[model samples]
Target: MKKGRIILIDDDRDHLRAASDWLTVNGFEVLSFDRADDAFKAIIDQPPDLVLTDLRMPGVDGMTLLSSVVRKCPGLPVILLTAHGDVSLAVEALKRGGEDFIEKPYDAERLVGVLSKAIEKSRMSQEIGRLQRLVVQQDKEVGSIIGDSTAIRSLRQRIAALAQVDIDVLIIGETGTGKELVAQALHYQSHRAPAPFVAINCSALPESIFESEVFGHVKGAFTGALSERQGKFEHATGGTIFLDEIEAMPLPFQAKILRVLQERVVERLGENRLRPVDVRIVAAAKTDLSAEIAAGRFREDLFYRLASVDVRIPPVRERAEDIEQLFRHFASLAARRYGRPEPQVPPSLVVRLLQQEWRGNVREVKARAERFALGLDEEQPQQSAFSIEAPLPERVSHYEARLILAALGINHGNTAQTAADLGIPVRTLNEKIKRYGLRYSGET
Candidate 1:
């Protein structure tokens, strides 16, 4: 294995030599520098695995050098060396991008430990960068969408087919199903690729601000209106405006959006001027708009207008074959973000992942994969239901039973407490205990 390199900078020649010798003996390739300038030059010339610099130097101080290294090589791990009572400066160094700090007159063992951690962190950062670039490259090559499942492939095909056609689109999917991503794929792969892609969440803003947010507002239109502002529609004139959670838009706002769709024009708030706008509308909803219309929450006419080109993204559970592809994609992404090597998703983890009900869908899986990649739970047990060939409900029951028993054990066999913690009634808990025949210590 190639040894990690360390650059140590201190004006004290004896201290530098001692530290270098100690690190070298412990298997690190150490480079010592007496001047801050020399250390910075070495860093720029060939970046080290880790940088250790004294806080105070003769001319160009350690803080300045640390800052320079961080800007030049953001992935480089920098450890600041400060004397006792100068701990505040060390902390400030950390805020300015230094990874850690070692107090002066450092213990040999402590210094080594800190240096080892810094190097590992730096290595991980570098690895994450490499993986992210690979992901970006692969994304471009395979098109922006990230899964290899038949569902995703069909989605890509639809996007490609519809890219040239100028029409309103209605995207329907459950929350966390990457609706915006599909919208972007349409925009990026379309004739409007060069134009802006503006996104708005209809559920995020208040009803009062809806008009001003979607349509430009003139100066003095309302109290506290200091200056004229352009709405998202005006900003997205020649491109695309992605309206997420379109079902949440109130009736009046929906009417305005419908008019924009039909007339290709918008009148700014507090102004009678009708501005002609040429933009593609991609509206997304977590529920069926027709149902909302029937319930009087969404307008029927607006649904027809937006559904000129409708695309439904299936929930993750419905696309079980895509789970592993998505997991690997996220694993690679997380690896890049954390500067760690692309972690292998053990066969067991893949199985557990497939077994998950995934109510939160792809987003939840991405978050879990990220946590796993960061080594938060190295020995996390494989979920039993992931294997498609296995008996699913049986495996799920087995896992659930074990989990309930473990929770009961942790609660010291207190049925009421366990029931409360598990969000079930005491009667239900007692029934389960009997049904599962859970044996507790002190019980026959």
Candidate 2:
């Protein structure tokens, strides 16, 4: 493998040819020129790993070339070479952003070593800059999907990988599982990030205007078509079009979508000319598309086309351990948005939260958190009715239940630990839990 690409500039033809030949032999790709001006132009046009130029030249000398490179392409390495190697001249070169100074009649091995070091350093700097930009972009794009569960981690990894390759992707998840959010992440992370991200709800659009809305219509295409309008596909050109709830699209329109996807072109309703489109299609489905296809509600061919890549999102229950963190995250956001202090969620309340089934997934959790933050849950007096108006025996039972629930919450539903903390036997606690109809994690 080549060590690095070098732009060698020297007025001395003999020295230039000899150095180029030796460097080439030593696994360096060399572009040798006798004029500094020509070499500077090449550096600007197609940058090399390192620039090796004579300090003394007839026109557009090495000092001028070095200054131009430092001003325009900062961080690029430029090494000055001269037969008249003065200490002051070398110091000046260093001050002017030159990488290093070498006396001409240079030692071949030392020259190769210096060039390699500069190239490696430059490459490292470029790599670090690239990685920093990538980290910021990833955080901005995929950071919205908050969770540390293995499933979420894997989903993020898949999103990151899929974002690099522009292709049609089908995101499969239950309702309120953030399929559209995933599609947005894919669009923002891909090369088409700067372009428009047009999202359309397939189920929301009526069949009568589906084609015109998606493929566009020319001026006077119909009674209401007074102006030339760009459709969703045209608006999303050079970017992505997210078709949410794609399974709900009628079967007849599925054939039209299939044609657009296959041909990468669209014909407006009143126009005969077909305009080519450049877009990455990302479709989402809440239902099992295979079942839809089997029931003849969706086209099998369109399913195959959209499902070039399938990304399945795990429901909230699947990542139950993330519930507490997710709840807190949402509560904090709600607090900020409402300009209210964040509520402190007690351990017992969290236990009750974990007990209920979140049928709506993250969306349900967010709604609950918002209500909690706004103190709406506290307004439900009947919900928290531990009656003091009842008899002593009833009051005592309610107090006992509250203590046990709190203990269980603190111990994270460990019955044995709750029993120990409450100074009761495990069997006694189990009987009480059964009698009171209390929920606990370890109950089998």
Locate the minimum summed-lDDT window of 10 residues in model 2: 377-386
Worst 10 residues of 1 by lDDT: 376-385
- Put down candidate 1 lDDT per residue, 1-444, tens digits, no spaces: 535898989999999898899889988998899999988888899988988889998998889998898878887888888999999988999888989898878899998888887788777777888988686557656435666688888988998888779888999999889898899888888888778899999999899888998998988999977788889999998899999999999888888898999899999888888999999999999977777888899888888888878998988998898898887787666556445566777888888888999999988877677666544445444433246566877666665665566556546578888889999999987887788776654121
- What stretches of model 2 exceed 4 Å from their correct place? 1-143, 378-444
- Tell me the TM-score of each prediction against the true structure: 0.55, 0.55
**Evaluated with lDDT, which candidate comes out highest?**
2
Candidate 1 global lDDT: 0.82
| Number of colliding residue pairs in each model | 6, 0
- List, residue by residue over 335-434, the lDDT tens digit for candidate 2: 5644557678888778888887898998889778766764555522243335657888887887677567656745758989999999999999999999
